[model samples]
Target: MNKGLYFWKTSRIPGKKQGIILAVLLAIILGSVSGWYYLVYIPHKKHDEEIQKKKADVANKIKKIDDFYEGQLKGGGIEQFTQLLNEIYQSRMILGLTSYDEKLITCKPDSCTFGYEILKSHVFNVQKKIFWGKEYSASFSNKGINFSGIPSNLKDNTTLTNYRKKRDVAAVDCGRLLNYIYAFNSISDKSDQIIIAKPPASSVLDVESEVKSQKKSYGLLFSTWSMNAKNDPIHIMSIFERQAFKESFIIKGMELKSKALKITGSFVCKSGK
Candidate 1:
C-alpha cells in the first residue's frame, strides 16, 4: 500500500468516532433541559400564579368593607345626624335661644322656632315617647322611630297618683307629655347661656309666696315627670324666669310644697338679665 493512502484512512476512522461522541453529549443536554422545564419550572410557575390569585381576592374583600363605610357616611347615617344636631345647637346658642322661652320674639313665634320646627318635622316622632321613661326603650323602623315601654317594678304611691291627677287635669296625652319632657331636657343639656340656682329648703307655698313678693318678671314654670329606677314616679320642676331675681329669692322658690312635688333649681334659663 502507498503511505499517503494509509495515513488518510487512519485519520477518517478517529474523526467518525469523535462525531458519535459529540452527538451523544448533545442529546443528553437537550434531554436535561426538557426535564427541567416540565418538572421544576412548570410547578414553580403554577405556584406563583396561585399566590397572585389569593392576593387579588384579599384586596377585593378590603375594598368591599371600605365601600360600606363610605356609603354610611354619605347616606345621612349616625355621623350625619350627630352633625346636624351640633349645627342646630350652635345656631340656637348664637341667637340667645339656649333655653326654653314661652315669650314670642318680634321676628318669629319664638327664639327657638327654627330648632323646634326642625325637631318636630324631622327628629321628633310621637312613637319615640315610649322610650322616654326608665322602662321604655327605642329602635329604628321604616314607618317611624318605634319604641316599647316595658313596665318594670311599678309601685302604687301618692306621687304616682298625684302625677296621674295632674296629667288628667292638664288633658295631655301620656306619650306627648313624655316627649315634651325629653325635648326640654335635650335642649337644656345643650344650652350654655343659662343660670341654674341651688334648690331651696322651704315649702312650695312659701317659695311661691317669696316669688310673688319679689315682683320681678317671670316666665315659664316647667313641670317634668318620669319614673325612677325603682319604677316610682319622679316629679321635676324647673323655672324659666328672669335673671333679675336675687339668688336668695331663687333659692326660696325652689322648695317643694309636698313630697309629690318635683323641683330642681339646677335648670334656670333666663331670657333677660
Candidate 2:
C-alpha cells in the first residue's frame, strides 16, 4: 500500500447514522427558533403595540375634552351656546346641510327652497311675527362642539306640582316655552342609539289655541323615536341622561323577561299668560 492510501484507510469516515443525527440536530434548532418567533414573540409584540395605541387614543380624547371647556368659556358660556344651537336648527339652515340631522358639522348657509312653498301657499295661513328691536345675525358654536347633557337631580313630582299650582301661569314668558322644544331637540340629536322612527310631518304636531282666560298650555311634545342596542349592551344611564336631561322623564315600566324597557314621559314645555 502507498503511504497516503494507508493514512486514508486508518482515518474513520462518518457512518450514515452520524450524518442523520447531525441533520436532526440542525432541524430541531431551526424548528425551535421558528416556534418561538411565531408562537411567543409575535403575539407579545402585537399586544404591546395595541396597548400603546389604546393609551394614545385615550389621551387624545382627554385633551379634546379639556380644550372643549376652555373654548366654551372663550366663545361664551353654556347658555349662549345652547341658544345659538337652537337658533341654527330653527333657521332650517340645518336642513340645507349635507350632514343634515347628524349635527357633526355646522351647516353651510344656503338658498334651498324646500319650505318656501309651505310659506307661500295661501291655504297655510302662517302668521309672521316680527321684532322691532335690533336683529343681530346668528352666531355658531365651535366646530366639534361639546354639549354636556348632564342630568339634574330630581325628587318626586309633588314639589314641582305644588310650586306650579301656587305660581301664577301668566307670569311665565311664552318665548322660553317655544324655545325649549327646539333646544331640547338640538341636544337629543346627539344622543347615542336613540333615533327618529320616522320624520313626522306638520300634521303630526298638535297645535293648541291659547285659552282666553288662563292662556296656558302644558307639555306640548310631538316626537316618536326608538332604540335597541346593536352590539354591546346600551349605556342605559348615559342615554337616559342625554334624552331626559332637557325635561322631566321617568322610566314608567320595564318587562324583565324580554329585556325590554317601556318608558313614557313628557318634557316641560309649559306656556302661560
Provide TM-scores for the models: 0.32, 0.26
lDDT of each: 0.32, 0.34
- List clashing residue pairs in candidate 1: 204-257, 235-262, 237-262
Per-residue lDDT over 37-109 for candidate 2, one digit per residue giving the tens place of the 0 to 100 score: 9999999999999999977765654444334322211221122223323443343343323222222221111
Q: Name the best candidate (by lDDT).
A: 2
Q: Residues 23-61, candidate 1: write the lDDT tens digits.
A: 999999999999999999999999999999967755554
Runs with alpha carbons beyond 4 Å of true place in candidate 1: 73-83, 89-273
Q: Candidate 1's C-alpha lDDT?
A: 0.32
Runs with alpha carbons beyond 4 Å of true place in candidate 2: 2-10, 15-20, 75-273
Error of 2 at 199 (Å): 20
